[model samples]
Target: LIAYGWHTMVTGQNVVLYSRLHLVCSRPRVLRGILWMIIANWFISNVPTTVFVFGASSANPGPFNRPYYVWERLQLCLYFVQELIISGLYVYEVTGMLKPDFHATPPPQKERRGSVLSALGTGKRWKSRKVLRHLIYVNIFIVILDISLLIMEFIGYYEVQVLYKAFVYSTKLKLEFRILNQLTDIATSRMRSS
Candidate 1:
């Protein structure tokens, strides 16, 4: 629960920073939609977990009852869905930014391939694509782990859920730190170059 709260706070911080630094408010509706989804998901996923974890419900007998277990799994699913939406939004934004302007001189034929390795070998645009790819991969990994955890819980492996949640959330936080750092570096370099 604490991990969820921390992740939510970090996400909220990122949203605020992007809005202020990039004028995201003036961007497409998708950006605003992503912002609201992140905020709403954070609240939706955190509130029940927080209540069960630290509120009077903790004292209830067999707090991990069938309904509680189902609710928890649903929350995890919702969390991953939000992650997917955020990642997709990011990819959309990055690709849009990287799109060649028709009025500008087109790149040579050799520079037009869309392969992942080719993108990585390129310059600033490549950096943005690489970071976005990393973000997608990380989110995919987390979704897989989350599904495994949910399965374990469903199959009466409740004993490991606490430890698993701890490990997963901490690892996710570290990944988020790396992602944020890379994004900041990319933005700073872009600003300087411009």
Candidate 2:
């Protein structure tokens, strides 16, 4: 039951992560690759972990113990890498967003430059960059949380590690609201500008 619960929670977190990534990134290839990665990891990690977890608790657990011991670490490592890849995509796309030179619109020749456009654009860009920076900070903090959980697991703190994992993912989900509003604002501004 715990395994089932954990699986459902972590899987939802990955889905949320992918949805957020889809917002800022437009390339179909990148998005598809990430979706496939999520599905693949879901099968590759969760199935075996579930099997090993149940088996290890059975009455005659000798055979399953060694496998479970190795599998627990492998599963966590897989999740860590999966998250890093998703976060890496965000950082890449966000970095490109911060570079607005190519996307900048030319000022009208008839009118004075940057009167209304410059003021609005400058303020929006500043806020956007600040939001992007916060996004990066959130990612870093998440990575740090994952690292701490990984360390606890490796050091044989299985009991605490499981509870900590739930906390970390919940915290990550909470932070997404900050990015959500900022992203919506950016999209609305872009639409209006166009």
Candidate 3:
């Protein structure tokens, strides 16, 4: 159930990203892109923790059939690989954090110098109008990259949950069998000694 919830939550972030990316312009667009990056990172980081908490409950074994005991190990392996790729991409994205170039915008100016407020940075704090085009490009790239990452993350998350569930169940069965064997050994020894 938590797996399903995580799946839903990741998908929801994608929807929000898509909607906000379209209507926003300039600074707001950049803000939206940065927001997407943050959310994606948060969810990705939580994935390993989720796996630990739920064990392997997310894995579904209906597709792979053998002894039912052997189950499917490949799916779980794939989950780890996919997680690695997403984590790598996030590392690359974080490099942008130190990039002031991306954040630069046109500076706003006023013709009137008489206003007391004009002395403060707020009056001229904005980026110059000349660089608006570059800012637009930076924002657009952020939006596109964010959306792509989200799609990949959604796919990976589902796989992880399904594979985790199946693996946990198989492990539990093995543990139970071992416990029963120990009990049988003790019972047989008591009878023979008597």
Candidate 4:
């Protein structure tokens, strides 16, 4: 039950990250590649982690202890890198959308004239850009949370690390809905209006 729960939470969090890429990114190839990496990382990290964690806790733990210790460290390292890659991609895409020349298509005729008239005033693009910048901040906050988990993991408190992960993942999902969803809606509307 423990191993299964751990696998679900860890893998599920990555899937959520993967699913949100469409909000800021338009490239299907990049999205597909990332999905593959997440799946591969799951198999590469989870199986041994489950086996070792279980074996290390068994009645005959002497042999399993050495391999489990080494493998768990490797597994955590893999997870951290996989997470950083996904978050880093999210940051990159959001930042790209922040650029002035990001959109390939020009705005409609009316919008272009209104944009010229309201040169001094902020517009939807500006608002979305602001939201996107704050989105980066949220990602940084999440990275900090992950760092705290690493600290706990290194401190060798397995129980506390597990509990803390649930808190961190829940917080991330809530932040995503509150902020990322706003940006997604903005992007979607712009695409349709264009």
Candidate 5:
């Protein structure tokens, strides 16, 4: 995961530099560096998290088992890493707002002349925009999914310790949340238009 992140960083630099040089490069290298670092951190942090997810799903062990111990530890480590990365990303974003560009320049004109939403249809920014949007949506779903799993874990720890049952329940919650969130977007659009 770290290797993949490093590779993405190397490639993303040239890609981002080419498309957004006019905007991002105008800032000091330090600011730009911090921005990229935050993203790289997020990518690296996901590695162990993914492993823990797969391990927990397959082994279906309670929190007390030797096998479950390793996965739980990995999950905790990944959570802490993600928290740190999120904090750093927040700081980087806020500090970037303090830079001279923040005062001198107006916010990048939003895509009002056209429509950023059009990216969905044209397949140009779809790779960048739509994919990213759905990724965010899925990540939100994952967090909710994790919360439900944690609750079930506690229940299992106290009561029956039925790992398979909790797994099924958590999986169902994840699917339901995903569907509801998609519906939420549609509902919001309708409400705003009305």
Candidate 6:
């Protein structure tokens, strides 16, 4: 199904990001937490939808046929909360990396930003910060779309909800791919320059 494909794409990107973060980030625990959250969210949100979509064709409908409106709402709520946590973890990691070491002595007046290390460090940090900002914006947009979908579903808009869900997931997958591409490009350029 479309949702399954989207889930797989998102999961693949997240796995790649997780590995990259493990290499570059100071906090492994945070990265692990984010990975776990992503796995959990995928299972909680996507698995049931997949089952329902596939199982609907069977002659004897399983328990999935039961209307679990409350379950759907709960899943959405958990998805939103986990996304907030994941985004917060990303921001935390980026900010932590960007924090200058206060214990180190200041650079000499003559050897300040002119040094290659300083220049590259500042440039990389700026790029990372820009990426972080983009991530935050993307997360906000996703949250907004999720809320809209939830509201529509609650209002008994089942007719359009299915189409909306597919569209939103596809759009989200595309945005995620864009972010991952930009990140990899940044990393590759930095590596080549270094």
Ranking of all predicted structures according to lDDT, beginning with the best and ending with the worst: 2, 4, 6, 1, 5, 3
Model 1 bad stretches (over 4 Å):
1-28, 50-64, 100-122, 125-129
Global CA lDDT computed for model 3? 0.40
Query: For residues 1-194, could you state the per-residue lDDT of candidate 5 as single tens digits?
Result: 43344234333432332222222234566546645754664555445445544555566645435545454444434443443343344334323522332234322447534665443223322232343355345445555554554565555452332443345334534543453354345435435745
Q: Please report the candidate that would top TM-score against the real structure.
A: 2
TM-score of each: 0.63, 0.88, 0.25, 0.81, 0.28, 0.63
For model 6, residues 1-194, the per-residue Cα lDDT tens digits are 65566467546645644554554466667777777877877787777766665665468666556534455566656765765565556556645643442233455766665787666656666676777678668867977887887887778786697678667667766776666676676667766966
Error of 5 at 188 (Å): 34
Candidate 2: regions farther than 4 A off: 101-116
Pairs that collide, model 5 = none
Question: Per-prediction count of colliding residue pairs?
Answer: 0, 0, 19, 0, 0, 0
| Model 6 CA lDDT for position 31 | 72
User: How does candidate 6 score on lDDT?
Assistant: 0.64
Give a tens-digit lDDT track for model 2, residues 1-194.
Answer: 87898799889888988998898899999999999999999999999989988988899889999999898898889989999999898888877866783456656665436488666766776777788789889889989998998999899998898888889878977876677677778877778878
How good is model 6 by TM-score? 0.63
Pick the winner on lDDT between candidates 2 and 5.
2
**Which residues of candidate 6, in runs, are more than 4 Å off?**
1-26, 40-66, 99-129, 189-194
Task: Give the per-residue lDDT of model 4 (tens digit) for 1-194.
Answer: 77787788778778778877766778989988988998899988888878887888899988888887777667777877887898798888877776653343465667767586344224655676677778788888988887898788778987888788789878877886776677677777667757
**Alpha-carbon deviation at 34 in model 2, angstroms:** 1.1
> Residue pairs in steric clash, candidate 1?
none
RMSD of each: 6.5, 2.8, 24.3, 4.1, 13.4, 4.6
Q: Which candidate is the best by lDDT?
A: 2
Give residue 108's error in model 2 in angstroms.
Answer: 11
Q: Candidate 3, residues 23-66: lDDT per residue as tens digits?
A: 22235555566556545654654554355435544375343233
Tens-digit lDDT track of model 1 for 1-194? 45466456546544543443243123666666666776787677766666655543466646545556666677767765666555555556554654532124435667667755444336655566677678668767866876776677667676687677667666766666676677678767766756
